[model samples]
Target: MTAMGKVRGYNAGAMLLHWAIALAIILQIAGGFAMMHTQIIPDALRFTTFQWHKTIGLLVLALTLARIAWRLLNPPPAHAPMSRVESGLAHLVHFLFYLLMLAVPLAGWLVVSVSPTAIPTLLAMSPDLPWPHLPLPAAWKGEGVSDLAGTMHAVLAYSTLGLLVLHVAGAIKHSAIDREPSFSRMMPLGRLPRQSTAFLAVPLAAGLAVAFFGGGLAAGRLGPESTSLAVNAAPGESAPAATGASAWTIDKTASSIRYEVAFSGNPIGGTLGRWDAAIAFDPAKPTEGSAKVTVDAASIDVEDAFVKSNVPGPDGFDVAAHPTVTLSVDRFEAAANGFVGHGTMNVKDKIVPLYLPFIFTESDGRAHVTASVVLDRLVLGLGLQNDSTAQWLGKDVTVKLDLFATRAGAASPQS
Candidate 1:
């Protein structure tokens, strides 16, 4: 095309980007509403739905930037002959669509960046392609910043709905009401007049788009791989050491330690992934020696992602500063159904009295044990700082232990 040539309709690149971004925005709006109102959706699908929402949102951001860059290099066809007021409204709505299309995703990213959960963003829901959070400090992840960003994200998203309606109405007026070839301008099968695209506009506009969004993502890579959320855990190879040897050797594969609490009237539970126990009690004697159970505070694995993140948070376990929670029992008393173990448990630097009522059944050389204990979160310094009233998080946490063990040695060596 010569310099004197005038563009008709949009170039191939511009049209492709325009439709791609439009489709993404529609998915994003629908997904946004679904994710926010998760109570209506099944529990198992909520996490996948959120990941898809983020994936599509970032897709919209990328395509929007590409569309802006393409529009710069290849200007659209001149507006169909229309009144001044009509053209002004079209330009205004188009400009806003571009603005919100970029701003909405950025705000959503902001919400994630400052979220106390510090949940990572994985592109295309692929764990391998992790998108870094903005290099914002972990200390800035307060409720205030998170709430503000969340509010902005939702507000901008709904605002785009208004702009979308206006844009489509304008296009329909020209195509149906005025009988102009407006929709064909962006249609893939439609033919357009020869258009001159400025190769010169490519470098400058594309450079800005890359520098702004790409550079930000690059800076994210330079920062922490992920937000800290105040969680610090020793490597998996490291575990707490037991104090005294026990008569029974634990079968780690068949043993589990679980904790449960109520969240918003729903039961939420998690397991202590790493733990060790030293027991000297004999099932035949019912109560004889001491027992110690040490838990890796960092090994908390909550079923809910949101609740999982908070477990290591300052208001929860504060795993960063307190790495382990230990419970030790020196005496056990025979009971009607089982036995009662009197102990003291330490959590978040707070030592509190702990009691576990357990049933023990032994046949041959193998023993089976089941224990359950209910503890007040406030007494153990758990969630006291975050929710003293237990409005959302329950005040009581119930811990249950089920384990299979084998008697390690003979009862007495008199051979």
Candidate 2:
């Protein structure tokens, strides 16, 4: 067949692939922006959105590759008559669109691969269906590499948007203004009425406006907020004095430290199976009390054996490297219900200021103290960054302690 006859229009397979990939890309863009921009999304919803976005991105990458292979094997239809420069510009735009479709998803994949948070990309939450791991250079296994890849992903995605606008505008112009057959070439059912094309353009423009402006507004309103609290002294600095306090011995059998956080939209509780504390306090003189506590990071137990074992690994606690977490409080201020202590916490090689509020009751030389505090996991370098992974695993961790103590050289407190 002659070139014009052979290339009269895209084959059935080409047209099917075109619409399939186009629809997937549109959904991916919408989901990506919505998930990234919206603040305070319920954890489960946010996780589901991210999973869909990642899955769709992978699908787009696969479909684009297949489309390219098909296009190369079977040449596209001959272009409608136009100026040489116009044709060249159209070809250049088409080429860039394809290039960006490939680049954008690969960049996104790289961002997920090197993320310090280390969330796995599982297909439909099935461990057996995870995306193939992409090997990283030794230097690329850090936040810096992830940040660079994230930037590239954003840039390429915007570039793809720009090219899409141009491509769509050219098609609309050819169909509605110039009254040409250009737009019909790839249409499975051939040319539509000019009125139908105009109707389609109206909704297309509205969708674009919503995606751009609505997304920007959501991001501005819902993005992460500053949660920094004031600290009296920097980490490792001298703490206030707590003298004139009687030393107390902690009753190991009755003392416990527990933490609670939201996981998969449910409240999950855990405990530090092994920990110790040294306390010196006098209920009569609250300001003269001090306490030091140490936690064995490897002993974190969340009820699930698999999760329990993994929590101590590099991506979670890195307990092998930083085996212990410690907190020392030497200053206390009386509160309406209890006393508040100012201190510093050392974990994962990062020291951060900590505040503890507790209620203390004493009877017959024995004391029972109940304390609680909320810590921003990120500040302590607890392997949770401000990325999607961190969002899935909530930011604030609530630590609660119950201690039974007695004056030094005294017997254990009677129940």
Candidate 3:
């Protein structure tokens, strides 16, 4: 090693990494606490907060790995003079910080992976980062264990605060009591002696960083194929592979039916996995349009294990007896917002009036459609027998449809 006096400050790369990780950790701690065990923020807003928390936690994990790699190749400045006992304690605190930086996020990731709710962790809550859940087997997922894992994540995260206090106190002690350059050594702008180290020129550092990230993904793949996050279908039932004899052909590949409801004030979104639409409509003559949609009653997947288990029972859709739900529209009327389909929805045995508002656009032979329908689940007796008071599950649910279709003779989008 070079003489201790020769290197008086951390490399620029080390300083940048330190500050970045510190900021991310601080954000995660504050956001994580606000989302858990508190009524500080409204439950509705917590949904967005939960996503922000996850996104920052992942960032901390990434930066921590990078910091570890940087520390390995670039030597840090020497410690301030102190007794052997004091030096050991400082080193131990640092070691624990690094360990928790890795463990806390990993624990959080595990909590999401095994959670019973079907919520996804969209990086930045945007569609861009398409982060996938850690693949784990069915045996590792459920309500009981998910709650326990959540508790562990919270506990591990709170421990970071204790370590932060000790770490800061040590820096202050070195600067104030010992009158040393402990804090200045890591500052970006200071009169401290700067060390010249090949920060990124080292191939070993890059290799270790890659290993750290790739190793985690590889471990997830080793487990059995992850259970479907949101999926529901009855035996022998499946989504149509191609357009049928309807006036328009639905491109199942280019379409989706998603539903959202507020559960305990937090939004729970899901999908109807097995459904098909038959359209006999002409955009040129809006008033002469007609359509019908059939949805497998058992395909109500909200991603809640308890909800899924009971959703097809006597108190819910009663799939064995009802088998399917249908929406039929006899005519469409021109509306300011595009068009409206005055329809009726049949759930089990009840027939309730419904109005679907949607916008439609056609180019060449393909037609694009997007519609939103808000229905009161209570009126239709969905989960009414079990949750009559609208206690856990909210009363109204919004179903969104986005699909692309082609005139019957035109080329199929799926084809």
Per-residue accuracy of model 3 over 222-320 as CA lDDT, tens digit each: 422222323335553333333434378888888999989877577788887788888877766867778888898878677543355456666678887
Sort order, lDDT high to low: 3, 1, 2
Q: Candidate 2 — which pairs collide?
A: none
Candidate 2 global TM-score: 0.56
- What C-alpha lDDT does candidate 3 achieve relative to the native structure? 0.75
Question: What CA RMSD would you report for each candidate?
Answer: 6.0, 12.0, 8.9
Q: Estimate, for each residue in 56-125, the C-alpha lDDT of model 1 and write its tens digit.
A: 8877776677677777667777856778999899898988988999899999989988876555676665
* Model 3 weakest lDDT span, ten residues long: 223-232
- Provide the lDDT at 129 for model 1: 49
Off by over 4 Å in 2: 1-7, 38-44, 191-260, 264-310, 322-381, 384-392, 395-415
TM-score of each: 0.72, 0.56, 0.62
Error of 3 at 125 (Å): 1.8
